[model samples]
Target chain A: MQDPFELSPSECEALLRAGVVGRIALATPTGPHIVPVNYSVVEESIVVLTSPYSLLGTHGRDSMLAFEIDQFDYEYHRGWSVVARGRAEVVTDPAEVERIRKTWPPRPWASGIRTLCLRIRWSELSGRRLGTGWQPMEDLPVHRVV
Target chain B: MQDPFELSPSECEALLRAGVVGRIALATPTGPHIVPVNYSVVEESIVVLTSPYSLLGTHGRDSMLAFEIDQFDYEYHRGWSVVARGRAEVVTDPAEVERIRKTWPPRPWASGIRTLCLRIRWSELSGRRLGTGWQPMEDLPVHRVV
Candidate 1:
């Protein structure tokens, strides 16, 4: 089997910044919930614009949340994944929210009044890459048999 | 702004069946965690193969979990997302596991010993689509000003 490799902190941060969409995980009284969102990286924090009544915006405030982004190449069997664990906070300060809007605006793909900006300052950032080592040769028994 | 639309249960199931990859959300002692995984739908349950010691394999068993899949088109601003919420169970029955393997095997993109098969029978399935309504005319004031 091939082995996966770990990515450095800087690499993780770069990937997070480059990502356009990600999944945010939140724990609620009902259960664990996950939803996709368009996001932007600003000042080393992940910012997402959402409706205050939405699932993410409602349960995410002051709660521990996880954000993840990944890309996979099916034919090449190569991929990279990044995960960020942090606490979700509402950007209440109008000045700060406006600054974020001007610099790196979070645009929701789904149309709605996304006036509330949620910021997640990750306490932990980690990433991994798949198919980085020891690809099975075509002539190998495993490949030939399969 | 364009309005988002809700998808029916049948539409949600069809989307889930068509998806090959999804994110699974789990609540742990540390926080809410989300990770991508290759999966297959069988008997109306989502199945995934993973290592017994991995975060998902270990904590996912008997836990309330959330599974999500989505697709987005940036140019047209169109997309659909589906979410499945349920409790995870380990597929320990040899015959059942073999049947699932034959029908739709879970192939992990990341290299690992993926011997354990877990199934999540979702109690709730929901979906939504974006950019399905009226589109603002490009020659309108909002477009011209921007």
Candidate 2:
């Protein structure tokens, strides 16, 4: 694939490690709505916590899931999107959670216990970005601009 | 209402008229997701082009919808959020859309007629903003950041 956003594996890991904030994507009966989540980065996977009543907990966990984390520099017109696609499930055992908690601590948002951590386990993790050195907008024809 | 960042009716009209890109939120089967959509202000509402299979069309149109447009200066921490809360419906009549097309042209992203323009009837519109003061992170506790 002649993809422009060719980022190195280490670079991908760095962006994933940058922070725990990301947008959780899923479908609901009424429609799709997005919410910010404070996440924990664990062994090549992104984990999020939610309660049973949470929409995601209701529709997603144990179902197909994807987690996206990115950073954008507007002045430079460059950004990268890294998504992990896999299954989501509820973590019920406290001992298992305690074992994972030492390394990946669960953080809370203003939202609500509806927080169930989703683990996206996939190896096809990669990213794309808009590089520099584009011609100025002034050089384009009126029709081209359109 | 001691609202700090309220825009006048005309200002709100202009914001929608300016054709600033708006964020579209849709509920997906996996979870809720958000993406950028180019739109124009029409007849006191915000409109965007979407496909029939698009999440919004499948689960959102004619259902409760929420559209948000924001102008934020991250460096300055002074910005505004305009939220449109209402139901969305697909425009079926050609004449009503023809009236809309005169001002708001449709620029479809993907190639397909399955994608139609959705008019977000936002009768309950409201806005709020952050002040231009440098409130140190230290001054406010973690729970107050929200």
Candidate 3:
């Protein structure tokens, strides 16, 4: 049985950049909520488009959050997972938000008027890969590319 | 533009039963953590095998948690997501654990001892499907089958 290995910072960043969909965990008064989101890596930060009135958009601001992206092959039982722990902030500055949108605009799969942009300024980045040996990223199937 | 619809209890349970992998959200003192896990549904409870010393297993006991399973199609831009929120408990009963093991044992892709069996007794079950029209279950690709 092969053991899971730690991924280096560069490897983790590459995976994060390649990923288009991820789950964001937020702490709420009711409990911890995990919601899938479409994201883009912008200037070493994760940015997503959401509604300001939505639960995540409202409660996520200035709160600690965890963002995760992973790809798993069930047939081979091999996968890689990356987690980013950070504080979320709402991008309210019109110029800043427009600049980010121009560079890395988040196109959410779910149809909605996602006008507010939320950014997660990650403090810790960690990842793990489950397999025998690491292979070139190009060899793997690109599941989602946004 | 399509609207997201609420899923019925039966639909949510069916999706849970069909899923083989899910993400569990745990609130830690430092921050909220989200991690992928292999899980099975037994008696309407989500069961997973994890190491007692691991971050999730150690801090998940009796804590409010969220379990999420989802399938998304990038080409079609449609998907369904289910979230189960409840308190997590360690299954210490030998008989019950043995029964769960025999019924639907979790096969973790990541190598670990994973002796502790954690169960989430969900108090709230909610789901949403992003699309214009709902189709039959068989029409959708079964990404995860337990």
Tell me the TM-score of each prediction against the true structure. Answer: 0.86, 0.54, 0.92
Off by over 4 Å in 1: A133-146, B133-146
Error of 3 at A89 (Å): 0.7
Question: How many residue pairs clash per model?
Answer: 0, 28, 0
Clashing pairs in 3: none
In candidate 1 the C-alpha lDDT for residue A97 amounts to: 89
List residue ranges in candidate 3 displaced over 4 A. Answer: A133-136, A139-146, B133-136, B139-146
The per-model DockQ list reads 0.36, 0.15, 0.68
Off by over 4 Å in 2: A1-13, A72-78, A111-115, A122-127, A131-146, B1-34, B40-46, B49-146
Chain A TM-scores of each predicted structure, in the order given, are 0.87, 0.75, 0.91
Error of 2 at B105 (Å): 6.2
Query: Candidate 3 has what TM-score?
Result: 0.92
Candidate 2, chain B, TM-score (2 decimals): 0.74
Model 1 residue B23 CA deviation (Å) reads 1.0
Q: Give fnat of each prediction, in order.
A: 0.79, 0.21, 0.79
